[model samples]
Target: MTDKAQKPSTRLIAVTLDEASIGHSTPDIEHERATAIWDLVEDNAFFPCGDPGTGPYALHISLMDNRLVFDIKREAGEQVVQHHLSLTPFRKVVKDYFLVCESYYAAIRTASPSQIEAIDMGRRGLHNEGSELLRERLKDKVEVDFDTARRLFTLVCALHWKG
Candidate 1:
């Protein structure tokens, strides 16, 4: 075995949250969703950023600009927050987004290197489909107030990348 010390992996994006993503004021709601979502995530291997977690601890849920933010980090990224969600039925919102991220990563991980390479050449390539899926997970008319959705997009894209 090589004797060199393994380098500590670094994420370029980091997610940060204030007290608003779920709004502590709505503790009843926050607690319920946080608990459920947290549990659901814990069982899964990858996080929004495609990095596996001890659970869902890295997803920073907070309220920002009157919307809930599910901040996430993946693939050498830092502080990449989810698009602010301001629609009702928060449970459904969370559920869809989580599923989309989870499914994408699963596909990316299992695909052979040759297949992954083919992803770039397909008509509906991996990148395009992934972006569409992410976009679909977001509800219409919801407030996704990020200067550039790419911050969150980066997180989604990061999922499936092997460190």
Candidate 2:
């Protein structure tokens, strides 16, 4: 991990999801969203390409016209850059993540410990896959470390929640 203190300006300070774009979410989805945001703000590396404003950034995420949007700004609310990533590349992995998540959640309450662990492993794998894809997709626009990408992937999956 990069020394967060040394590169403090490259970190994210806040994250907000567009409520209107969120539609209606189940309690589980809401919990997932909250957890992802809390984890993200606690630790993340976000540096917009070609912008050297020395900014601890804030990110506003939303989905508009079937595109995933990343609205980055300085911690003090000055615009930095905005990126719209195509959702096509994410569709399959996101779908698989959701399926594994559903099974994991269900297994947690009813299955044996070993069974839950198995499902959890699959869930984590899918999460990692999605995170890697996100990191690749954002490579040209914004640079993010693996953990940050994982948390961001969780938020992305939260946005895709249709319940």
Candidate 3:
């Protein structure tokens, strides 16, 4: 076995996530329950939008990582879905990635797995080219397993994206 060096410090610990690790893809029941719990523990919030164009977002159930984000798209018949979200897995103390992921798993317990579609925008202005860039920035942070982060994101969305 190869020996690994211990990290000297975790001050730079910052939780991060990608579009693929969210909670809305789950069933309404599960998502609602998760979001309900989240609403009980948030300060401020907002709905995520425009892939955030590589910037901040709104969170309802605030954890760690002072950043926020959301995915946005216009659906058929003038409906728009802005998938807002939040995370807490940049371990300055301990590894919390799994814990955060657990929340996602719990929320998605009753839902079917789905795929995120590419956002199409030729009518209004919804730039979506920074996805890879955002993903790259989020690489070093934690991840949301089984839609756990969605419940957390619900907190942000409900509160209109506040910390």
Best by lDDT: 2
Q: Which residue segments of model 2 deviate by more than 4 Å?
A: 1-6
Estimate the TM-score for candidate 3. Answer: 0.21
Runs with alpha carbons beyond 4 Å of true place in candidate 3 = 1-35, 38-138, 161-163
* Clashing residue pairs found in predicted model 2: none
* TM-scores vs. true structure, each candidate: 0.29, 0.93, 0.21
The most accurate candidate by TM-score is 2
Candidate 1 at 44: error in angstroms?
2.8
Looking at candidate 1, the ten consecutive residues that score lowest on lDDT are: 1-10
Per-residue lDDT tens digits for candidate 3, residues 1-163, read: 0011111111111122343323344465445545555442232222222232221222222223444553322221222233322333222211232333344455466434441121112101111112222333334242222122333333333322111
On lDDT, who's better, 2 or 3? Answer: 2
Worst 10 residues of 3 by lDDT: 1-10
Instruction: Compute the lDDT for candidate 3.
Output: 0.29
